[model samples]
Target chain A: MSEKAPWITYRPELKVLDCTIRDGGLINNHQFTDEVVRAVYDTCIQAGIDYMEIGYKNSPRLFPKSEFGAWRHCDEDDLNRVVGGHDAEKTGLKLAAMADAEKSDWKVQVVPRSESVLDLIRVAFYAHQVSEAVEMINHFHDLGYETMANLMAVSNITETEIDTVLESIAPTPAGTMVIVDSFGHLYREQIDRLYKKYAAAMEGTGKEIGIHAHNNMQLAFANTIEAIILGSNRVDATMLGLGRGAGNCPMEILLGFLRNPKFSLRPVIKLLQDHIIPLRDTVEWGPLIPFNITGQLNLHPQHAIKYRKSETKDDFVKFYDELKSEI
Target chain B: MSEKAPWITYRPELKVLDCTIRDGGLINNHQFTDEVVRAVYDTCIQAGIDYMEIGYKNSPRLFPKSEFGAWRHCDEDDLNRVVGGHDAEKTGLKLAAMADAEKSDWKVQVVPRSESVLDLIRVAFYAHQVSEAVEMINHFHDLGYETMANLMAVSNITETEIDTVLESIAPTPAGTMVIVDSFGHLYREQIDRLYKKYAAAMEGTGKEIGIHAHNNMQLAFANTIEAIILGSNRVDATMLGLGRGAGNCPMEILLGFLRNPKFSLRPVIKLLQDHIIPLRDTVEWGPLIPFNITGQLNLHPQHAIKYRKSETKDDFVKFYDELKSEI
Candidate 1:
């Protein structure tokens, strides 16, 4: 490594996306108060963050808007109420919403970029959903919106499955293809191999590789750093890692590591202190033992998430034995 | 990057050292109870850990007995009380204690191997104390104890200083030379460089390079894995990352990552559930905001440790400003 290695100074092309509301909604059914969402939006602008993923754009029919919060739909009125018609040109902070394959009714829910506040539509899917994800990305692109094909749960997929997904999405209009460590099971070595594969597949597509890591094994930030070192420019983080089970990479730590002069850490710190930490009373996230077990076993966090709500939440030995027996 | 990487298979030469009691003792002034120590001792044996550092061997003159605990001195009587004369032959687990440079009266404290339970004497010192550390290692080696030269706070030292210290310890009788990230400030890129540097310096000496990482950046386990990938066999971890500030690499996660089948995660999980989690009420550790800031700035965690006790502990913006002004 040279004295001027990218780790020392950062890549200028790097873009950090704050997914506090989008992923964090998984724990609380997208029920974050408008006050919390607005605080996150303001923090993203002040902190010079490149993008802020507000929430998911899943179908109201599938999620039932009566039960889920307004963010589950990310309606035009609900988004405007929180961000007041976010102007990406003025703030330099593009707004994004994750649209999961099969879960989202993109044909009707995803309006043209000119009509919505969202600048990007992140198409999340598993290996089997790659074909639909490609169509979603192209559709969103034709609607004049940026797009990313986030392949979720890549750790659980086979090498051939990953290759096929990459090949299918390689020719799409997605501006970025992300290596989503949905289970937080990947180590830096695996991140290195996956990054190389993604980079090779998107060699001439001009599409950047992104990283969206979970903190189940406490490697989210570390894995994100590893991805950045290997030239993954689009990265995802959340305030205080307030996402789903075991959260996402923390935005504060990620900003501290990135040497981009445009990024500021104070606003993020303030938001974490004032807004995110208070949510701990009703929301539980971080690399707890249950999540760590799931991450280590390369299993979905749903089991650990359910077990955390049980009376025997602290019975790690029982959890481990049960998880292992299932394998 | 190969299919059969070292990460996929076990390295028989690799040795894991559980520093739970020793490092975790810092938060409580080496005040762990007999039950806690005994539990950790038994866990190490059942988990098939190679070595367990019980505590520091500093002199009573430097640290008064009343102010500290028995682990600070690690007297034979206390060792016997907890472990019942830890027999390395029978348990396949070696007991060790850290003796800090200039603080330990090794001449009077470190008894001969035949007269005590300690199998290894870890000599921890700063760059300026390398000469003293070398002499201490030699003194302990003559007494028939295996030894390690733990260069503390390598992240704060200059390259030339590191080279000088490595040169001085190369000819010593120490069995391992540890890259101690005392401040928890190193990243994987830095770990790669430091590992290569230490490996080259220790070449042909038949000495192994070790890693003793702190988790201020939540990178302890990740960095430890990086070192292991680069052939650092002697690794240090504590249960639940229970150490001074942000703690050390977590033993449970480390055991989970290592491919060695001899190491059992069940013992570690049980220990965490039964012994470590209960201590959280009295002892606070982990990568909180204060510690994370200090780690990112490459500063000692003492300031963060002190700030964590203040009335405005959660006022991260104020803390960040004050810390930055000092820098």
Candidate 2:
């Protein structure tokens, strides 16, 4: 792809997906209050966000009804309460929900798009789970919902594995192939290489590339911007980066860089100041050193998250020692 | 220039400069305790940083002795107390200090290299002050100290003005021409353009391009990494990103990225935990909304700094309104 000077003009095809409630819920077991979810939904409308990912479509049996909140399943009533009955035709912004490959009971759980509030169903899966992801996407597509096949933990996957998965996903009904930096380990060069590879693999398939970066090494915004510059049309961000383990790219930062006239940063800033910043006391996320270590090592952030929650959060040296010993 | 994959191998020519005390001092008026300064010095040594900028050579007459601390002037005795003495040959790391174009009395205040502990003199100048900066670099070069001509507030300079200044700097003895993002307004694409511009301007001069970024928009580290990826060898960072309105890139983040076997991150982390984090209580800095606004508008962060100090620090909308009115 040619290096387009992004400042000269805006890319109308570029779509931003705010996954605050869905991703942020992972930090607090999907127990967001109606006020918080409503605030984010309103902010999305005012900020001109393309898609607001309300929550997941996972099985309540797996997550348990009492342990997780309504967002864990995104029951139509719960979503309707937030958006005041999601009228897809009237609402300026579209709604999306995540459905993991193995964890989600898509066959029984996901209803037709005409019957549901969600306009999109993003199917998240690992490299080995591409077949299941394809099935999930086909199912979602047959239901008339825009679908994305998000390959998770991509930094840990090998080149051969990634290529094989891309080939498998090429003919799937999924319209977008997401470059998920699950560990947040890859830097700009890696993002560049991956974007090129994904673009080349999806050539003539009418599929667009997407980016979902974690802020582990504090490069989520940078990585997202890199993918956008390299021609990724879909990007994922969370308000104030409130996802698990250092969070995803902050929506405010993404809006600030997009320079699109339609996107208003003021509402996003207001939401951050009024709603998201207050969550800092109860929720823990951001670029802590342990997270950075795990991100740099291309390891899962689970150990880092556990260490962060432990009483010895300040003892980075000991954590580093333990981490290296495991390696 | 063709894009080279940095992940294939580490850039051996890259040099990391830690300017924690000098930059962080802006937040606390250069009044860092001797203990803190010495701790940073020790950390820099242990962390295997190539250079440590202790402070500035600014004239006390301009800043006033009573108002600013010893670091504002960087008296030989004050520097000697930290380094013990200038023994660049014996010490693995070299000591450096900054000198603003008109703010510093470089001709008389800067002593001969043999009489000082400093191994380098970095002259910071605005676009209009390149002549004075050139003269300062010449004097320092003559005095047997390595020199760098840092063009401050590069995001605000016009393309024509930048060309004229770069042309003027080509003949100077300064071994490094720095792209200083004084306002921190730039994005990755801008950094790429600047790096390419600096590289083309300094072609065949045997001089290296350096990057000094502020964290106003939380892009300092990303911009620094972009510059490095595009072949800027000399990069500046501070511990915990402690500096003015926003701050600089965190040294720990930079060291973690370098991938050099000799660089140890533990020392930087320990210093942050022991020394820098405590300073946050008294000195406010980092990516606040007001600072980000100024950075985005390509304006000096003085007004944002003042707004942050006042009782209305929480009123982001008010600040935005006032900032836009002034703009």
Candidate 3:
């Protein structure tokens, strides 16, 4: 507190994105209705959020069924129908979509090959596929979409691989470089190390940093806090942590720490009441105690998410018996 | 990446206290059934949670609204019945209560106070009454309840004022210091500074740090993450994030991050599915975009919380027009 500025010395001032709908839609198989999507986009616009991701526009031909991919938004035309022609007053809100590296062939991912309904294109790359993602980001960059490379499973990557990838893209004109926690398993220390890595990689380049967090380990919000505090310009979140598996960092939680008041917590509450609440009746996405203990133990929580679903019957005793031998 | 030790590190090992029943009761007027309470207590026990706050134990005699304040197990006898004789094997949980420094008399706040039943007694203190809370913690300590001073609405206090009050609790006995975000408005930097204050004010002493967060502006979980990363021992959350106004941190998110396989995400999911989902059909919690904006603006969210509840057809619309100004 004495020498360095406070922990919040650096944060993004340009714009924010609430991914509750896009990321959260993963939990429900991307089945969110147009009405719900419309309301979400409307609120994002009214709240002055700079971008609202309607859904993934990448062609289904790109994804391999074995890879466990979910298209939070499946159709760009449908997305455009919902948020495309909002009154002129809602102008600055650009639509965005996400695509994985292993999935879509970049050439086929776009619907209108020459024209993009979306303003930005994000390439979410598995750690092993940074090169492919780089090529895609370059492709998007060439296509005039504000390109970004969202490196996934970052905690598992070595510095040498990270350096190779960064050195490749450091000179490219990608708008921003993002550190995406595909597994939502990072601590403040991990984020600090990662932040400095990404920051240093972009040292002389003209680009900003973006963070996408998963809450599988409950570090999503904390990790985001650390990233923004360390000078990252963009932070992403979903409503109610609605993404796949353990979900993404919650947008609502981020609202609490963002030093500004341009956003409203009311619409989020309303969406909870109107859409999110109803979804909870049918879908399940939240934390469990075994996962908490595992976090305490520095273990994986996916097994707990599985165990919870299996615990309702006399199965708990058997599951324990089986896992005991391996656990 | 070369940094050996990060100043702040989020250790997911902290214990989580889920008060969904008690806090959700705020929205539901304490309407939890015995089955629901029993199920939640039992699940948390199997999960190895440290604290299961049954409900408000403040004597109904302390308030004119006795019926309203008697929430869940307010009396020691009620506590015994709800948890079933405090066998460590069954619930394996210690009980806690929210004792108001101003509203609760010592006798009413702590009945049959002893380590045998309730293990922790947290004294909720308004910014103006830290001395009273200190006295209460001292008394509870003498009576055998592990006590803490939960400084509330801390966002309103000046550093100098907090320094004076914290100085009174200097030499804090084991487990007697806390920094509570009553308004849920404090951001990352505020928490960092405050935690530093708490650590400096109680260095070398046996006191442990506790964080009780509100979701007024949706920062509860985020701030709790900061607190944990900065080295606090306990973090407060509620089932489904149920509490006053917005609510507290969602225990599921905490547990999700904890990463223990024994602590199933299912029970928490089931709780949400069976308890919260239907309840949400009638009540709402979570960050609304409008409220997210207000929090972004660094303004109090209570105004938006109030405005959104208006029964008037166009109330929210009318309210939104004057929102950024009224607050």
Best-matching candidate per DockQ = 1
What ranges in model 2 sit over 4 Å off?
Answer: A1-5, B1-5
Model 3 misses residue B274 by how many Å? 6.9
What CA root-mean-square deviation does each model show from the true structure?
1.1, 1.7, 6.1
Total backbone collisions for each predicted model: 0, 0, 48
Looking at model 2, residue B293 earns an lDDT score of 82
Query: What is the Cα-based TM-score of model 2?
Result: 0.97
Would you list the rank order by TM-score, best first? 1, 2, 3
lDDT of 2 at A70: 89
TM-score for candidate 1: 0.99
Between candidates 1 and 2, the DockQ winner: 1
lDDT of 2 at A177: 98
Each model's lDDT comes to 0.93, 0.89, 0.66
Candidate 1 has an lDDT of: 0.93
lDDT for model 3: 0.66
Q: Fnat of the models, one by one?
A: 0.81, 0.31, 0.17
Interface RMSD of each: 0.9, 1.4, 6.9
List TM-scores for all candidates, in order: 0.99, 0.97, 0.74
If you assessed candidate 3 against the hidden native complex, which CAPRI class would it receive?
incorrect
Say what the RMSD of model 2 is. Answer: 1.7
